[model samples]
Target: MKATNEIKPRLDVVSRAITSIVEGVCKENDFDIQYSGIESTDGLPVRQLPAIWDALKTAKARMNHQMNQLISRITHRWNLASSIHRLPAEVLAIIFQEFEPIPGHPDGDSSLLNLLLVLRAWYDAITGSPQLWRSFGAHTPYNIARLVVDHSKALPISVDWRPPREPPKRDLGKVLDLAIENSARVKSLTASVPHEGDPHL
Candidate 1:
């Protein structure tokens, strides 16, 4: 038998074959199939119903899997032929840097974090670029700050620390201390200390 991949049927032929199969099944069972439901209220054999249901479920799963595979292959091929992928690592890194969130912007880390999830190539390009990780926001956690510092590769980093309205569980002093330890590398700093009336200052 020929492999399934080797068989290429025309779209019309495939459609007709499917239609014929449905028509034949309906004709043999003395059933009239409709879009919503069967026309006749006649019931199928109880024993055969389970088998048919299971077969339909299995076929549906198989079709879904095959469709997913086809889509993935097409996406992979499209990416391969894309000009973005052809860019040099330096150029790609610059592009990724452009996606970095602006200082003091809410949800600062989200954009870069999402970029990391796009593709392996994009992840590699962003991760391998140290300059892109130089900016740190006030809400940035210790671990994330550490990661950015480590990746900054001795380059100067920008720090933005805005006092929150509510006091945080973690010691803000310690967080500042961590950033202070790397203060020599600090290029741009923006910090707001809470005041007596304004906790959000």
Candidate 2:
């Protein structure tokens, strides 16, 4: 949660602190804050005392927290340095609109949506671009269909009701309702009977 300005310096400090302590720690398991530091658990002079144990526990907790912070700092740096991060959100939105679904990808837009969320930038681009949500089909998953409808906002949308399967789709009714609810913005519609006994049907 630290700002970039704060994170860079703090990360350097954490890295230095970790490097310093790692030089002193005798082993990975032994965590002690004694002046001379703890080399090992076997026959450690302070191991028998409660205060020493408390100090070690605190040290362990501190190390764990620091490790977590280190990971966060690294991730923050990675995101900032990533090539995708260099692309503007508007450009990402345009890219999303131009992208086509993979051939025979069973999950359709669902997989694309899930994949786009890996980066904060891509997620924002997809969710914030109403034009990207302006074209979808009745067979889309209910939740995804809703997202498309809601995110499309006042933009005109094109609906495809051509079924992908024999039974059509279970969510067809819900998708129809969504289209009708936003009928004022429905600029284009495509639907037809399955054509009984048709080979593609």
Q: List per-prediction Cα lDDT, in the order shown.
A: 0.70, 0.67
Tens digits of per-residue lDDT, candidate 2, 163-190, equal 5664556776887788788888878887
Candidate 2 residue 6 C-alpha distance from true site, Å: 25
Q: Which ten residues in a row have the lowest lDDT in candidate 1?
A: 33-42
Q: Write the per-residue lDDT of candidate 1 for residues 1-201, one digit (tens) a residue.
A: 889579777887866655554444545555544322343323555555555455556666776898899989988888877888888879998888877755563556458878887777888888888978887666766676777888889888898887654554274566678788999999998876677877443
Q: What is the lDDT of residue 185 in candidate 2?
A: 86
- For TM-score, the strongest prediction is 1
Give TM per candidate: 0.68, 0.61
Q: What local lDDT does model 1 show for residue 45?
A: 56
Show model 1 residue runs off by greater than 4 Å: 1-46, 105-110, 141-143, 164-177
The residue ranges of model 2 lying beyond 4 angstroms of the native Cα positions read 1-39, 44-62, 100-111, 166-171, 195-201
What are the RMSD figures for all models against the true structure? Answer: 7.1, 7.5
Span of 10 residues, lowest total lDDT, candidate 2: 100-109
| Whole-structure CA lDDT of model 1 | 0.70
